[model samples]
Target: MGRAHVSTHQSVGGRYRLVEITRRETNSVRWYADDLRTGRPCLVTRIGLPEEPDGAAHRAPARVLRTTESVARLCPGRIATVVDALDEDGSLWTVTAWIDGTPLGEVLAEQGTLNYVRAARIALELLDVLDAAHAEGITHGELSPGQVFVREGGPVVVTGYGLAGSTTAPRLTAPSYAAPEQARDERAGPAADLWALGALLYTMLEGRPPFRDRGRPEATLKGVDRLPLRTPVRAGPLARVVQGLLRKDPRERLTRQVVREVLTRVLSEDSGAVAEAVPSPRLRGGPALALRCADRRWSGRTTVLGTTLAVVTVTVAVLAATQSLPGTGSAADAPAASASAPGDRGASRPPAAPAPSPSGTADLPPGYRTYRAPEGFSLALPAGWQRLDTSRGADLAYRVTFGAEGDPRTLAVTYSTGVGSDAVAVWRDDVEPRLERSGDYERIGSIRSTTYQGREAADMEWYAEAGGSRVRTFGRGFLLGGGRGFSLRWTTPDAAWEDGASREALRTFLRTFRPAAG
Candidate 1:
C-alpha cells in the first residue's frame, strides 16, 4: 500500500498568489494565479472536498500529478503540463503552467454558434490527444470544454487527464458531457470519452449541450442518460457524425478510426488556408455557464445569445480552423443565393430555375436547374436532386455525389488538380483498372475519345451491380489544362438507362458543365 501525503499550501504569497478566476465548474474554481517562486502567471484550480476529508484527498493530487505528467510526456505539446497539486482548507488545488488561452466553455459563452469547419478541426485535435491517451489505457474520463484550452497560434491543449477515479462525483467538471454509463455510475472506458467528445462537438455547433442542464447535477445526469437528443439544425455535415458518437450503447459508438477518417476527409476537402486559428471566446461574455459539474451543482439562469451573422467576415473566410462554407470551397465567398442550406439532405426541391446551357442561355431542359456549387463548378441537375455525399482523396481530389431520396439515379462530380494530359488513356488505364477490379463490372463499349466543350475528353459506359440492382454508369472525363480535370459519373438503374429522362439529363450535364474558373 502506498502512503498519501496531505498538506496545505499557505498561499496568498507563500508560494503562489491568486490573480483571478478563469472558470468555475461543479465544486471547482479555476484561477489565474502568479507563482511567487518563479514570478510566472499560472492557472490554479480549486475543487471543494467533502465536509469530512479522508485518504482520497491525498490520492487525488498524487493521481493528478502522476497521470497528467505521464500523459503529457506521451503527447508532448498537446497536453497541459501540471506543476503542483495539494489539499488545503477542505478543498483540492491543482496548479499548472499558465495557458495563454481561454477555456472552450468560455469561447462558446461568447461566440454563440461556431463555424462548422472550426468545430471539426477542434474535434480532430481533441481526438488526436485522446487517441494517444487511449492507446496507453489512459482514459481522460473527465473531458469538458472547461478542461480544454483554445490558445492562439498553437494546438488545442487538454487538461484534466487523471480526474476519473480521482473523485466519486458525477459531473464534477461537466455534467452535460457525461456518458450514459457515467451517469448511471457504471464503469466507463474509452467509449465514454468518445461520447463526451460528441457532446462537446454538439455544444460548439448548436450553442448548447445535447442534454439541457437541470439545475442539479443528478437531475442533469438523469436527463443525459434518459433524454433523446434534439435534432441539431446547425451541425451541417457533422450532424450524422455527432449522432453516431452519442449513441446510448457504448458498444455501438463509432470507432476512433472511423471518426478520424471522416474528420480527416472533411479537413482535407478544405483549401490550404484552413490551418488558421479561430477567434477565441470573450473573457466576460455575458452570464457565463455556472459550475455545471461536480457532485452537487447549483442552478444558474442561462441565456442563449443569438446573432444574425451566420457567415464569417471576409478576413476569416480566407482562413480555416474551417469556415464550413459549401463544398469546402476556400477561394470563393459563400453566396447568400443558396436556396437550401449547404449540408441539407432533405428531398424537397426549391422552385426550379431554368437550366443554363454552356452558351449561358436558360433554355435547355424542362425538369433541370443549373446548380452552381461553391467549389467553383456549375452543372444542370434535375429539380429534386441534391448533394448526397462528399469524399476527398489524396492529391486534392474530391468527389460529390447527388441524387434525390427514393430516386435510383445518381450523379457524381469528381475534381482533381493532378492528372495527365491524355484523357482517353486516363479512362482506359487509370479509371478502367479500378472498375475492372469491381467483381460485377462489365464494359458497355470501347472507351470513346471525344471533345467536350472544346476540350479533350473521354467517355466510358459500364454496368455494375449494387444492392442487388444492375445499374448502368456513363462516365465522362475532361482535361482543363495544366493537369486539372473533372469527371462526371451518372448511374441509373439498367432498366431506366434508355429512357428519355436519363438521356436528357446526361446531355444537359455534358453540355453545360463549367470549371471553377468559368
Candidate 2:
C-alpha cells in the first residue's frame, strides 16, 4: 500500500493502533495498524457479524482464523497469512502482515481501463491460487477487487480466503462483485469464485462493475441475477472469456481450464482481428462490436500491412514519456537525423530530426550525452553508463543492455528480423511468456498499444524480484515492416521508479534514440 495520507488514532484490542483506513467494502473495513505490543505494522480487517444463535457467532471468528491458517499454509506467499483472528465487540477482526501493495479495486479506480493482456495475466495468477484452494475443497466465497493486493514487484497477494462460509448471509461484501449463484441465494462453490473472477476481470477492463451497487445489498444482488450485461467496448480480445465466465447459469459457464485457454489465446493473437466479428449489445440506438477472443489460431503470417510512408517509429518512444504525460506526446523529438537511417522496410523517406549530440556539449539535459553505436543505433545516455550485457538468438535477434556499474537501473535495446504482425501480441505472447519463466516475474499492467513516431507500437510494464529488491521494467517494441522490429527495455528499482533521475532518463532515451540505418 502507498503511504497513508490520513491517520485515525483509534486503537483496537488495546494493543493495535489504527494508523490509516486502507479500504472499506460492504459491512467491512480494512486498516493499517501498528501492533503496539510488537511495534510492527499489520493489516486488520473488521466485519460486522449478523446476530446468530446456536453459538454460530462464537464460531465465526474461529472458522475464519482456522481456514485462513490452513489455506495460507497451502498457498504460501500467494495468499495473506493470518496472524490473528478475534471476535471483538460484535465485529470479526482478522489481522495479517502489512502488505506493501495497492488494492486491485483502487488500481482500477485510478487507471480506468487496462490492457486485455494485462487483465488476463492478473486473472491467470488469481486462478493459480484459486486452483490450489479448490483442489483442497476450499472455495474463496468472496473474491473481489478489494480482496486482492498488487505489490510493486509484480506479484499479487489475495485476502479473505476463508470468509465465504463464515456468515449465513449470502454475500458479505462488495455485492456488485457477487456471483450470480450468490445473487440467486444459491450455495456458492468454486463456481461462485469463478464468477467473481469474471466480474473482477470485467471491472478491470471496464471502468465500472457489470452490476451497479444500488446503495443496498439486495438491489445489487437482484441486478446481478436479472440484468443483461452491458457489452464491453474496450475488452477487445477478452469478450468471450468474460461472457463465458459470466453465464447466468452456473453449469453452463466455461470451466476454469477453458477460461484459462481463452485468456492465454488473447495474449498470443491479434485482438482487432477477432473483435470486429463479435456482435455487441445495442446501446441507446445502435449496435457495437464486442472484442471477443478469436476461436481460431493465428497463422504464422503477420496480419497488419506496412504503409509506404517512410516514417520509422521506435517502440520505446512512448515509455520515454509514459510517466510524465498521460496519453500525450512531447515536442518534435524524432531520432533519425544523426548516426543512423531507418531499416529495410522498403521505402525511401526524408530524414528525421537529428539525434542528441554525443559531446555533452549540445543543448541536452545535464549529466547526459549521446552514444553512437557501431551497430547503427544512437541514444542519449546518462554519464558513466556503459554497455553492460548482450545476447543473441539464432534467428538474428539480439539484445544489448546499458547501465552504470553501481546503478540499479539499466536500459536494453533489442533488434530482431523475425517480428510478428502484431506488436502488442509479440509482447503479450512471445516476450511475456519468457519473462514469466524468469525469477519472480510479474507484469504491472496491460500491454498498451499506441502510436510511436507515427507508426504502430506496443508497451509493457512489469516487475521482478532481484537480489531482495523489487525491480520494475518497461518495454516497447515496434515493427519496421516484413517481420522486422526493434524494442527497448528500461528497468529500475520500484522505489526509485518515480524519482527525477529515472524519469529524466526515460524521457531522454525516448527523445534522442536514433534507429540504425538499414
Candidate 3:
C-alpha cells in the first residue's frame, strides 16, 4: 500500500475539500471530505494505479462512475452512492456519500474479535448485496473489510463497486482478500466475489484475514494462490460457509442461493434477528423471509453452540409446518452436552424457597435454585445447570436449553408469538409428525390434552436417539391469546427417564415455572 500524498485541508479537483484520513489500506486510502459546491459530507478514496498506459487510466473515471451507478440503483441503500470519479495526480479518486458508521476493518481492529452471531448478521448483509449485484451481472472483486461500513441500528453499507475491472490489475486493493483466480491474474468471475465474501467473514470472526499481507502485492497474491488455507476455529456454524465460499476453484464455490440459506440460518439463531428481518430479499419473489429473532434479552448470548445445529434446521422448517407446507414442527433436538463447566451457571445461588402450589405443597429439592431468563420466563433449575444453547425464529419464537456438565438431562424452554389457539392440534397435527423424522423416534403414549397454569395445553412423551444415545423427552405446550404460546421440554437419557432424579427435576421445573412477569 502507498501512503496518500494529499494532506488534510487540501482540495481534490478543486471541488471537494479533504478533512482527514479516515482509513488506509495496502493499495488505497480513504478520506473524509466536504463538498465545496453542496456543503455536504462525502467519502473520498484514492487508489495508486497499476503500471498501465494513460489511455486505460483515463477511462478509469468513467468506468467507475458508470458501473457504480448501475449497482447503486439496483441495491439502493445497500450500496454507496458515488457522486464523482476522476483521474488526477497520477491516482484514481472516487467520492461517495458519507456513511454514518465505522469501517468493518476498524471495528475489528478495536474489538479484536466478534461473536459469531454478529458476524453472521454482517455476513448476511454482505451476501444480500452480492446477490443483488450478481443478479445484474456485476462482480465486486474488491470485497474487503475496508469496503464495508457497519452502522448502528441499520444495515451495512458496502462501497468499492466497479474497482475490480477498473484496470488490467486483477484486484485494485486488499490483495489478501482476492480470490485464487484473481491472485493468479486469471479472469475473475462471480465466484471470485463469493470467495472474497468468505474471506471478509473469516476476518471478522478470526480478527485477521485468512491470507496475510506479505508487505507486497505480488507476494501476498502468490500466497493466496499457492498456500494452504487454515481451518477457522472460531467460525462455529459459519465454518462450513467460510470453507464453501473460499474454495480454490471458482466453479466449486457455493451458489448465491445456498450461501443466503446458510447465512440466514446463522442469523436466525441470533436473539437480535427477531426484532428485524433479513432485509426483504432484493429480488421480487425471492425465498421466504428468513426467521429472525428480536429477543433483545438474549442479544449478548452470541457464542454459537455446535449442538444448536439441529434446532436451527428445525427453526427454518417451523413456518412450513405451521402452514401445512411439508415438514412438521419438532423442537426435540439434542442438547449441548457438557459444553460449559458447572460454575458457569449460578452455582453459588442459594436453594430456592418452596414454590407454594394450589395444593399448598411445593418445594425445590436441595441443590436447586430459581433461575430467570431474559426472555421473560423463570423456573427452578438443578444446581449447576447453565443455558447451553438458543435458536430463534421469526415473530419472536425462540428455544433455550439448560443443562449441567456431566448431566444427561436438559430442560428447554420455547416461546413462540405465532401458533394456533388449539394446543393439542399444534402437537398432534404440526409437531409430532416432525418428531418422527428425528432418527429412531417413537411416541411413548397418545398425545394427551392437559392444562398448564390455567391455559389450554397438551402433553406429549416420546423417545429418540440424540447423538447415538437413546433419549426420552416429556413436552408440554400451552397457548395464550393472539396466537402466542410456550413449550417446556425436559429431556433425559432413556436409561435415566424412570429414575427418581429425573422425575423430581421435571416436577420442580413444571411446578415453579413463571412466565415473563406479564
Candidate 4:
C-alpha cells in the first residue's frame, strides 16, 4: 500500500493551520502536529534505514521535534509553526512572506544610470544595515543585483535564511559578484559584502558585470585577473571612487569610512561645481555660451524712430544748398562773395556737435602684449591676444591662443600649496622619479636665475616621448612664501614646435609674462 499521508499544523488538536506529510519508502505516512495551547510550532522528519519499516518514522519525527525545540530556545525568535518530512514523494514545499518591488538588475537595465546623489545616499544607508547584519553573524550568502529589490524607499535584500546557512542544500551561486574566498567555499565574511558592493557599482556605471561573461569559467577568471578599468570620459570623481572600490584585493579596497567620505563629497550640492572644474566630454557643449554670458550686464538698446526721417531731411538740405550754388569751375571759387548775405552767417556755422563719450574723453593704456600670472611670476603673450580666465578649482588660471589655421595652443597654470623648497622637493621626490621611470625623457639645461614679470623664477626644460611622439615640456616654478608655490608647464608636439611662427609666438608669450591678481 502507498504510504499514508500525515498532516502537520501549527496547533495540535485544533484545526490544522498548516500541514506537512511524510510518506516512507514502505508506503506509509506519518503526521506531526503543533499544539495550539502552546502557540509554538514544531518540526518533524523521517529518520531510519531505508530497509526499516515505515513505522520507525515515529522516533525520527520525535528527534526532529526535540531538536527544533532546542533550537527555538537558543535562537530566541519566532517558533517554526510547522515542519513535516515529505513522503519519500521526493518533493519539498516552503513558503514565506511575499515582498514587493522590482529587482535591482531590472531597474538598472531600464534606467541607464541612477541618480548618483541618490545612489550614494542609499549606499550609505545600506551600509548601516549591513553593519548590523554582520554583527548578528549572518553573511548574506547570495548578494547580487538580482537578489536585491529596488523599492521606492531603498533596496531590500530577500533570501531564505534557512537555505542560506544550510549545509545540505547546494550553496547559493553568484560567481561573478562573489568574493574570491566565497567562490572557493571558504568562510564568507563581511568582506564578501564589500566585494559584492564593488561589483554592483561597476555594473551600475558601465552597464555590465565587473567580472563575468558567458564563457568558460577559466577564461572569465583570466579576464577578471586582467580587468582594465578606465574612467569614462565624462565620469568625474565618481569614476575614481569606483575604481578604488573595485580593487582586486579586498584589503586594498576603500574602507567604510573612506567610502562614506567619498560618497559625501560626490553627493554634495557643490559636487557639480567641482565636476565643472574638470575637463570632461559631457560638458563640451553649451558651457562655452554660458561662460561668455556669465559676467555680461545688458541694458536695452536705444531705438531712434527718426533715423530714416533724419537721413531724408539731411539729403534734401544738402541738395538744395548745392543746387542754389553757381556752376563755376569750383563752387568754392564762387562762394567768396557771400559773406555779407543774410544766409552767410548761418551757412558758415559748424555742423551739430557729436555725441559725448560715456566715460568722458580719456586716453586708454597702450595695448602692449603681456601675460599676467598670479604673484611671483609673469610672462608676455603675443600682441593683440587676451588672457582667458577658466574658473576651475584651485588650478586657477588657463588661456588659449589660436593659430592661423584655427588650431589652439593652450596654457595652464597650477598652484600648489607648498613652499619653494617643498615645491622643488615634490618635483625631485615625486615627479622626477615618475618621469625617469617612464624612460622616454631627456633632461635639458636648467636656468637657475630667471626674471619673470620682474620676479625671480626658475625654469627647466625637458623633452619626452608621449604616445610614440616627441613632446617638448617647458616648466617654470615660482615660489610664493608661506608654503605656497605655482608652476607653469607648456607642452607642444615636436612638429608644432618646429614651426617658425609657433616658436616665435611661444617666445613672445614667455617674455611678456606678468603677475596677475590672485
Candidate 5:
C-alpha cells in the first residue's frame, strides 16, 4: 500500500542492502538483500498496514515477532523463521532467514497446472503448518500462492505467518484468494484460511484462481463474495474437496480434519501422480538456498492491482499501525487477514544536538535546538530529542520521526515523490479514506486549506485511543511542485495537549521546519 516504488541497491535499516528486486505485488515487494552485520543473505518484506489513530504502530512489530516466533516453534521446518520485525517510516519490514525456494506463484507461472498428487502433497504440508497454528488458536488470515515457497525437491516453506490481523486492510496482498467473509470486510477467522487453502489448491490445479483478480482488490473481493465459483475441469479427484473449501459460507467450509483426510487419501491413492522426490539443487555445494524467487524473471502477471489505494494512504496507515502515534487507533482487536505488499526500514541514530541554525537559534524555545538531518530536512527539537525511526517505501517515499525517551509526543515528517497537486484533494482522496478505516478516528473539524511558508497546504486534526489513553494529532501537508510533497505530523496525549510545553513544541516545529532542498 505504500508507494509502489522502491529502488534496488539501497540499504534498509543500514544493514540489509537490497541487491535485487526479487518480486513485486500489489502492496508489497520482495528483496534479495545482504545483511551487513553478519554478511548473511536474508529475505525482507515490506507490508503497508492500515492507518490508525493511536498506539497501533508501537504494538505491531512486537505482535508480528511474537506470533512469528510462536508459530515457527510450533512448525519447525515448514515455516520461514523471522529474524526481525520493524516499524520504519510507515511500513512493516519483516526479515526472515533466506528461503531457498521458488514462490509457488512463480512456479505456477513456469509450470502452469500442477499435477493433482503434487498439489495434494503440498496441501498436506501446508495443512500440517496450519494445524499446528489452529491448535494454538492462531489463524493465518492470509493464505495465497504468493505466501508459499516450493523447493525444487518439493519441501514447502510458508512466510508471512504472523501478519494476519496486523492491520485493517481486509486482504493486503491477494484479494482473489480472500474468503467470502474477508472479501465482505467481515472479521476473518480460521475458516478464512481454509477458503484461501481451497483457492490456492484451485489455482494449483486450474492455473488460475477460482475468482480471477479483476484489477481492483475491492472488485476481486466482490467477486469472491458474490460470484459462484467456476467449476473445475482439471481438478480431477481434488475437485470436490476444493469446492468444499471454497464454500461461500464460512460455517460450511470444509474443516481441517476433513481437508486433511481428503488430501491424505488423494496422496495415498494416486501414488504414481507425484514426481519422484529428487535431491535439491545445491548452492555452493551446500543445501540449495535462494531468496524467494530472487533469481526468477520479474512477472507482469503479478503486480498489485491498479485499483489499490494510493501510497500516501498506505504510508499513513503503516505509520498509524507501527508508531503508536496519537490519533491513530489500536489494531489489537482486528482479526488477522493476509500479507501481500511492499517495503520496510527501521534504523535508529544516536541522539545528537541540533546544528546551529543559519538564521540563529537564540529565538528558539528554552532547551530546544535545531536538528539538521542528513536526509536534507531540518527542524527545531527539544534538547534530548533525536532521530528515533526512519522508513522508506518502494516509490522512494520516506518518513523520519524524532522524539526523546520517556516522551509520549512524536513528530513525523514524511516526504513523497508521487503526490497529487492539490493539497485538499490529497487529504480527501488519498488520506481520509485510510483514516476513516482506522479505529476510533474522529475528525475535529473540516480539512482546512491553508498556506505554510508560502506553499499551498491543508491541515487535518483527529482524535483516537492509544494504549487506553485518548490522543490527538494535527497534520499539515503541502506540495513542493513536480508531484512532490511533505507532511508534518505532531501527536500528543489528549490530556496533555493543553500543557504549555506541548503547545509551544507544536508551534516550534511548525515555525522552524525546512524541507530538504530539491
Candidate 6:
C-alpha cells in the first residue's frame, strides 16, 4: 500500500482554508477547499485506492456522491463545508468544522468521571446537535466518546456522514461506540446515532461502555449484544434512562423524544440529580425498586408517601391494653368493640394518620403516595418514609423511600398510556431476552394469571447485578381496564427483606392492594 499525501493552506487573515492532497497509488490528485464560513475548523476525509494498469484514479459512483451531498445539507452549521470528491485521485475526502475541545474519551480517562451536572449539560447539548442531524436524514454513523468534542461551549460531534456513503473499499475497524448494525455494514440511520449516544452517555456516567472488556472484537460484539450495563454507583436516574437507550436491539431502545425528555429532566431539574453517594442497597440489606403504572383507571397515584403509609400501617401494630375500668361518661367515652365500625373506631384509628407528609429538605428522605380509588382500595405504609415529587413525568409517577426514615432505598412508579398486546409481547420477547443474556440476573419465580383488573398479569422475582453488586427485584404486572396495564417492582438487597417479618410486610401490602372503584 502506498502512502497518501495531504496539505492545508490558510488564506491570509481569513478563517477559510484549502486542503491539497495527492494519491501516489492511483497516480491522481485533487484540491479541495473549505472556507470555514461558520468560524469553526472543518473536517476533511480522503479515501484513495491504488492505480490499475491504466493508472487512472477510481471515481466514486454518482449515487454515493449524491448521498454525501445530501448528508452535508442535512448537517449545516456543524458541517460548514463538505467536499465529497474534488477529483479522481482514487481518493474521496470530506471536511467538517474543526470543533475545539478534547475528545470526551480523553476527558474521562483523565478525570475518573465527568462532574454529574457537567456531564448532563454535555449530554443535552450533544443531543441537540444529534436531533438536528437526525432531522436531515443523516446519521453520525461513528458516534463514540472519541468522536465527541467537549469544549467550554459544550460537547459537539466531530464525525458524521463520511463513512456511510464512502465509496472506498470497506474498512474493518469502527469505533466501539458505533452501533452493532453500523459495524456490520448495515444501513446506518438516526437510530444508530441514538445508540451511539446511549453508549457515550453510559461511558460518561459509568466510566466505561455498557458492554466493554479488554477482549477481541468478536468477544466485544458478543458482550455488547448480551451484556447488561454495570450501573454506576454514582449515576442518577439519568443513568438508568441512558442504559435503557443503550439496549442492543435498536428497536427496543428509546426514541429521540424519550431521550430528550430524560435529558431535559436530568439537566434542568434538581430532582433529576442522582442521590448522594450512599452504600449499595445490597450492603444496606435492601433492594432497589423500579416501578411503573400504566392503568388510567389506577389514577397514577403510586408514591413514596403512599407506599410508606401502607408499609407503616402494616408494620406497626397498635394494641390496646384494656383493664376493665368503669367509665361514668356518655357512649362517646366508651371504647368500641369493633375495629371496622365507622364512628365506633373513629377516635381509636390513630388520629386519622397525618396524610403522609414529606420533609422537603435535600438531606431528608422524600415521601410518596399511592392511588385511592372511589371503590375503596387502600394499604398501610411504613412510617417516616419520604417522597420525591420532582422526577420527569412526576405527574405520572410517585416515589417513596424504603428502609429507615433518614437514608433508605427509593422506589418510583410512572404511568404510561396505550398499553396493548404488542407492548406486552415486546417486553416478553425482546426486553426479557436481553435481561437474561446479560448474565446479571437469577430468576426466582414468575406467575402468569389474570387479576381483578381484567387484564393478563405476571409476577416475577429476580436478582440483578450492578457493578458487582446484587439487588433482589420483585415485580408484578397486570392489565388494567381498557388497553392499559401496570408493572409494580420493588428492589432491595436481599438482606433488608431477608427476615420473615420484613418479607411478610411487603407481601401483605401486595396482597391487600385492590383496584379503585370505577
Clashes of each: 3, 3, 8, 18, 36, 46
Identify the superior model by TM-score, candidate 1 or candidate 2: 2
Better candidate number, 3 or 6, judged by lDDT: 3
Candidate 1 wrong stretches, greater than 4 Å: 1-13, 51-54, 270-518
TM-score of each candidate?
A: 0.50, 0.53, 0.53, 0.34, 0.52, 0.39
Per-residue accuracy of model 2 over 1-518 as CA lDDT, tens digit each: 22211244557778788765456566666778899999999998877777877657667777877888777777777788787888877778888888877788666644555566567667877877777788778898888888998665555789997678787778888888888889888899988888898888888777667887765688989999999988866565677678767878777666776666665555555444434433333211122222222212222121112111132211111111010011100001001111222222122121343444444236668878788877667888999999987654433545678999899998877655423334554454334543664558877666666545555666666678878998776666555644345667777888887787886687677667756655
Superpose all Cα atoms of candidate 4 onto the true structure and report the RMSD in Å to 1 decimal. Answer: 36.2
- Tens digits of per-residue lDDT, candidate 5, 115-228, equal 676677678778777777877888898788768988754357888776777777788777888899988889988889888899999988887789976645788889999999
Which is the leading candidate under lDDT? 3
Regions of candidate 6 where Cα sits further than 4 Å from its true position = 1-75, 83-97, 154-157, 165-173, 183-185, 213-219, 226-228, 272-518
Candidate 3 residue-wise lDDT, 57-115, digit = tens: 67888888888889877777778888999888667899988888778876765565666
The TM-score of predicted model 6 comes to 0.39
Candidate 4, residues 1-518: lDDT per residue as tens digits? 11111121233224223333211111111223343444444322221122334444224334333443443343322223224323232222222222344445545544544444444544554454445455555555445654454455324433223323333221333346656555455666666676666666666555556775422333444555466654542233456556666666655665555555555565444454433333332222121111010111112121112122111211111100000001011000010110010111111211222221222222212433344434344544444545443322222222222222334444445443312222222333223433664577775653233434333344445567866888765555554433334445555675675565555444443444333344
Sliding window of 10 residues with minimal summed lDDT for model 1: 319-328
Q: lDDT of all predictions, in order shown?
A: 0.63, 0.64, 0.67, 0.39, 0.64, 0.42
Candidate 4: segments with Cα more than 4 A from true spot: 1-96, 153-171, 215-235, 270-518
lDDT of 3: 0.67
**What local lDDT does model 6 show for residue 470?**
75
